[model samples]
Target: MALPSAVKVFLLTMNRSLGHVRQVEARPLPPRNELQQSVLVKTFEELFAELRQKAAERPEGSGTVAALDKGVHFIGKKVVEEAAESWMAAEHEGRERTAEEISQLLYQAQCLMIASGLDLEDVYRHL
Candidate 1:
């Protein structure tokens, strides 16, 4: 399946950040509308690499698209809310509950990034 250009650039850029590749600047981002097929991902890190490409590439007027159209502040609020919930879950909940809460937090984080024209590589670079 084709990863949206945003995701690919994020991954390539992140790889460079880990010194697994050359500098991020040398690996240019593709145009926003570009699309390219990705290799089958087989690990959690690979799978964890980015937002689900399908979700990122969902059609206009789809529920995700509609929510995203609400703007970054809206998504940012959800990200904030989810982050708090994740923290609560980690402190007060069991493993499964924590996992569930983190999944939600992660999704909202992705929404925030997407809405802001950011991506997973942005998160990694901050580390």
Candidate 2:
């Protein structure tokens, strides 16, 4: 089955942000014993900081800037769409795919939060 145009666009934007283009090849996973140690570490706090900077700077060709320029409603819709995609990926695809979708969901949700003038501290206070 073919993906929706919006999904394709989102993937393209994400790929560009990651310095990737058109096709990406999958590399073999690490040995089971090394899996835990080999995992790439990241934090939403770091991501939010970057997004906040992007919002302030509006760098050329930045996906974050593009999303912010489109305003909160568009980012909100993307967050909702990504959430559904994440659920679908978990149900139909396996762990790796689910992780990818969840990453997208988090990015979009963060974009929404930034556009709404909220930050990690605001969310943490509520939780």
RMSD of each: 13.4, 14.5
Evaluated against the true structure, the overall lDDT of model 1 is 0.64
Off by over 4 Å in 2: 1-37
Question: Once superposed on the true structure, which residue ranges of model 1 sit more than 4 Å away at CA?
Answer: 1-57
Location of the lowest summed lDDT over 10 successive residues in candidate 1 = 35-44
- For model 2, residues 34-103, the per-residue Cα lDDT tens digits are 7657776557888888888889988999989998999989999999999999978976998899999999
Local distance difference test, each candidate: 0.64, 0.82
lDDT of 1 by residue, 77-124 (tens): 888888888878866887788877877777677666777777667778
Query: All candidates' TM-scores?
Result: 0.53, 0.69
